[model samples]
Target: MRTVDQKLRDRRRRHILTAAISCFIRDGFHRASMQEICKEAGMSPGNLYRYFDSKEAIIEAIAEDERKENATYYAKLFRAKNFLKSLGKMLGASLKKASDPNYERIALEVAAEASRNPKVAAMFAQNEAETKASLVLALRDAAARGEIDGQLDFEAVATILIAVADGAIGRMSLDPALRTTALMPTMKIMITRFLRPPDGP
Candidate 1:
């Protein structure tokens, strides 16, 4: 059902984005130039322009990719059997991702860019809202199954979880030497105690 030309186009777009990410990571988003990105992609400006018109376009594409990735992750999480355990694993995986220097740097840069760019802010906000909603639903389901406290406010708990993730990412950015794996045990214990229903096994 797919044509060769379409496949090639998709490949080229991915190449461009890969190059752009490297450039953005090396030289913050604002400083990364289209020319530099073209060089990194091993393409001329004329060719690269065919895929993305400007830096903002590239940023938008990256944000869209992130949104889709998050959706896929949440979909899998929702299907998981043990909600609290799955949530803990998800948090740990997220912390591991944040521990990557390049990822941490890019995340920080995106956060900074979002503050000044309304479009970027809106894009990230939508992703945040969607992720939080999914988390709230997961919390409610877990409660119904007696995995967590039934009386706890799922919405507030979801928000706090998101905040905790953001804080972890921010902390990683600030301390490159910090190892997320070392912190997991403590994090898991805290989450389990906070969510486990009273008198739970």
Candidate 2:
């Protein structure tokens, strides 16, 4: 029940976001002007403005897109039968994404922006809360199934997991030589040993 105009609008919006990301990655977020994004997007200022009033609006849209992606990923993790295995796979996938130079740059930019912009902070904070909650629920289910230690503090563990990912992102950004694929096996062993039930064989 979608109109052609609506579909076209959506496509245009995505196009603008893709162009904006490239600009933002090439230059820091503060240096990436709307005019530059317009040029990158192959659109006039008036047309780009119709889609996004300002850089902040574009950033908000990007955050929303990321939130949706995280939601979908966490939903799948919650439904997974093997929680530990699923969590390991999720972490591995996240590390792989963080290894991408563009993704790392964007992530660092967003984190810096969140510190300076209250609205950006709140948006990412909400996403973080939802992600942690989903992880906690998944962990609880895993405990119930005797897959992990029931006595473990799920909230703290969830926080640690997120922190580890953030740390990995930071490290990869700083050290180009650090390979996520090479580190994944060690990461898997650490997560397995940390979460597995005490009596687990």
Candidate 3:
């Protein structure tokens, strides 16, 4: 059990992260200053600094939080009766959230920053690698249970799936008119087709 002091500490850190995310989304990461984050968080510079020393630190914290979320999502996928369906629905929900202007801005900004910053790149890469590994491992287990195609190359397929999802997110962010309802059923069909065993090879 967390003590009161510990809970307060966690809450303050979360507050700082939330403020940093808003500032980063409003102004690009490079332009979002520590002062702005402090003001947005309603904390003094010295107080905010006690939680996060830099924007990079805050971003890293966010990445860590995302990884934990991904883990929970995967655990839920494994618990589902249909792994492929659960995966599709989960990713569909994610894409739908990405369509929101705030989510889109933050996702695009983080992806853009990852491209230019080695540390940020590693943060995302690690997350992706863990997700991909979980996907492949889960698919392999599903195959053993005769739930999916046992003969398929799961590693290759996982890569393609992740790439497609990332591309969809990018497109969703760039095209405000895009509809998640329009995309999800097709995504479900694609996942089923890709993972299900055909009569022949």
lDDT for 8 in candidate 3 is 95
Q: Show the colliding residue pairs in model 2.
A: none
Ranking by TM-score: 2, 3, 1
**Whole-model lDDT per candidate:** 0.88, 0.90, 0.87
Instruction: After the best TM-score superposition of candidate 2, give how far the Cα of residue 58 lies from its true spot, in angstroms.
Output: 0.9
Candidate 3 wrongly placed segments (more than 4 Å): none
Alpha carbon lDDT of residue 132, candidate 1? 87
Per-prediction TM-score to the true structure, in the order listed: 0.92, 0.94, 0.93
Q: Each model's RMSD to truth, in Å?
A: 1.6, 1.5, 1.9
Q: Please, what are the lDDT tens digits per residue for candidate 2 over residues 1-201?
A: 479889999999999999999999999887899999999999999999999999999999998998888888788887888887888899988898878899988988888988998988898899899889988988998899899999999999999999998898889878999999988888889899999999996
What local lDDT does model 2 show for residue 27?
A: 92
**Least accurate 10 contiguous residues by lDDT in model 2:** 69-78
Question: Candidates sorted by lDDT, descending order?
Answer: 2, 1, 3
* Per-residue accuracy of model 1 over 1-201 as CA lDDT, tens digit each: 469889999999999999999999999998999999999999999999999999989988988898888788788778889877888899998888778788878888888999999988898888889888988888888888888999998889999988998798888777778889988998888899999999897
TM-score of decoy 1: 0.92
lDDT-better candidate, 2 vs 3: 2
